[model samples]
Target: MSAHDFNPLLDIPVFPASGFAPLADRLKRIFATGNDLLFIQAEALLALEAAASSLGRPGLVAVNVVTSPYGTYFGAWLRRAGADVVDVVAPSGQPVATEAVAQAIEMLGHVDLVAIVHAEAANGALNPLEEVAALARAAGALLVVDAVASAGGHAVDIEGLGIDIAVLGPQKALGGPVGLSLVTVSDRAWAAMQSVPRFSPSLLSLLDIKEAWLDRGRGALPGTPPPLEFHALAAAVDRLEAEGLAARITRHQRAAKASRAGLRALGVEPWVADDDRASALVTAAPVPDGVDASALIDAAAAFGVALGRGFGDIEHRLVRLDHTGGRAAFGPVLANVTAYGAALAALGQVVDIGAGAAAVTAVYGEA
Candidate 1:
C-alpha cells in the first residue's frame, strides 16, 4: 500500500515539531534540560558506539550480563565496535550481582564502559542500576543503560542513576509504534562521542546525529522522519506525563502483583527466582507440568489474547505475560487473566477461573 493510502497509524511524520522537536524536548525535560542530549534514530547502535567512545577505546569493556536477548546483541555490537568485552554473567531468571560487576571491573583495571540493561523483557528480569552505576563510577567507567523495556514502564532518572547514555525504544512500554528509538546523552558522553572516529555509517553515527541535532534544530538528518510514530510517541508521552510517572509505575507494579498472585494460585511459579529482579512489563512463568507452552500460546490466540512464548533458550518451558503499556489497567488485567484461564481449560489443564479473576479483582480493589 502507498504511504498515503496506509492508515493514520502507519504514516511517518516530519521532523522538528512533528518528529524530532517533541522527542528532543521530552528527552531534554527528562534528562536535565541544560545538558547536551543527542537525538538519534538508530539508538541501539549509537549507544554501543557511545559506550565504546566513553571508555577511550580501553582494551577491555565490562558488561554486567543477564539472561537477556538484548545482552547478546549489545555484546556483539560492542565487540564489532572494537572493544574487548568481559561479561559478568548472571544465571537465567536473575539479575546480575553488583559484586560480580565490581569484581570484573576491578580485575580489568581501567575498563572503558559498563553496559547494562535496566529491564530485560525477554526474560522478565530487571537489573539493579543504582548500585551498578556506583560500581561503574568507582571503576572509572562510563555507565551505559539499555532502558528500552523499562523507560516508560517504570521510573528512570538518568542523571540520578549516573548513567552516561540512556537508550530507549518507543515500542515496548512507551505504548508507541516501533522503528523510532531515542537515546539521552550526557555532556561527557557527547564530548567522548565527538572525539571518537566515525566507525559507523551516517545513520548509525552518534557524532553525526549529535551535530545534526545541534546544528539543524531537530530536522538535522536527511530524509523525512516517521510522522505517525512521532505523533504516537508524543501522545504516549503526553499520556504518561499526565498520568504521572509515579502513578503509571504504581499501576504496572499492581498489575504485576496481580499477575503473579493469579499465576501462583494456578499452581505456577515465576521463572525468575528473585522478586526484586522482576520487571513490571513482562513476567516469565513456568509452564505447568504436561503443558506445552507453544500449544498454550496458540490456544490463547484463539481466545483473542495473544500470550508471548518464552524467547531464546527458554522457549517451550516458559510463558510470558506482558502487563505493561496500554495494558496496565484493572480491566485489561482481569481480561488477560480470564482469557488465560479459559485457554488453559480448553487445553485440558484444570485452572481455577474464579480464583484468577478474584486475584485480579483483589488487586484492583473496588476500583
Candidate 2:
C-alpha cells in the first residue's frame, strides 16, 4: 500500500491540539468533578505514579490501602518518594475493611494522605470508599483514589466525597483507548503538591502539567499529543453521554447480579461473599479442588468463550469473569457463566448447566 493510497483510517485528519483542554473538560463532566483536571499522554498507572511523586516527601505520613496490585504499586511509589507509608492490607479476594483504615489512622497519630483503590478489577472486589473518605476527612488527611476500574461501573462523586486526587483510566469501564489517562486535582491537593520538590521537569511531573497546560489558559498540550488516543477518548465520552451515566452503572450492576446468580446455581460461590463488597466490573470464583485453573480456562476458550484468570497470587486459585464496558450485557454475562459451567462439566465436575443458565436469564428478566 502506497503512503498516499487514501486509506480512510490512516488518512484521517489530525486531532486538533487545541481541543486537549476541552477534552479534559468533557472527562471532568463524566467524573462530576469541580477540581482541576489534566490528561496524561500515557496509561493511568503513570498518572497515579505522578500523583504519588508530587505529594510524597519526607515527614509525610500516608495510609495506603492494599486490596489489589495497583494499591501495592501506589504504596511503593509513595515510599520511593520518601513518604512514611502505613499499609492497610485486606485478605485475598476481599476489600479492606473501614475499621482497619480507622485503626491505621488512629495508630499513626497524624496522616498527611490516605490512598485507596475504589475497585479491584483484578480480583472483583469493591472498597468502601465513602466510609474511608469520611475517616480521612475527620483526620484532616487528603484523600487520593484510584478510580480507573470503578468510575463508570460505580458511582464516584469526587467533589462530594472530598477526594483530593483521582486517577481515571477510560479503557476499562469507559470503553475507551488505553493510550491516555485523566487526573483530577483538588485545590488542597495542589497546595500540598506545591511543597514537594521530588518531581522535576520530567514527563511524569504534574507540576509541569499545571504550569504548561492548566495555568497558561488551557489550550493545546505542551508536548506532542497522540491524536489517535485523543479522538478515541472523545468518542468514548460521546457514547457515555448518549447512554447516561446512571443507566450505564445500572447495566453493570445488573450484569454483576446475573453473573452471581448463575455462578451460585452452578454451586460456585463468588470470591467475595458479600454482594456489596463485590465489584460490578468482574465476578471471580475460587477454583474448585482438583481442577486445573489453566485447563478450565482453556476449555472455555475452546467453546469460544473468553475468560480471565486472577492476577498475582490468586492467578492459580480463582477464575475471573469479566463483565465490563461492552461485555456488561445479558448476552455476555450468560455466555460467561454458561462457559464456566461447561468448562467444569468438561473437567469432570457435576454441574447443573441448565439450572445455571435459567438462573442467569431469570435475573436479567427481573432486571
**TM-score, every prediction:** 0.88, 0.98
- Stretches of candidate 1 exceeding 4 Å from the true structure: 1-19, 31-34, 42-60, 216-220, 348-350
- 152-223, model 2: which lDDT tens digit per residue? 999999999999999989998898999899889999999998788844578778888999988998888888
- What is the Cα-based lDDT of residue 74 in candidate 2? 94
Residue pairs with backbone atoms closer than 3 Å in model 2 (clashes): none
Q: Which ten residues in a row have the lowest lDDT in candidate 2?
A: 197-206
TM-score of candidate 1 versus the correct structure, residues matched by position: 0.88
lDDT of 1 at 129: 83
Q: Judge candidate 2 against the unseen true structure and give its global Cα lDDT, from 0 to 1.
A: 0.91
lDDT of each: 0.72, 0.91
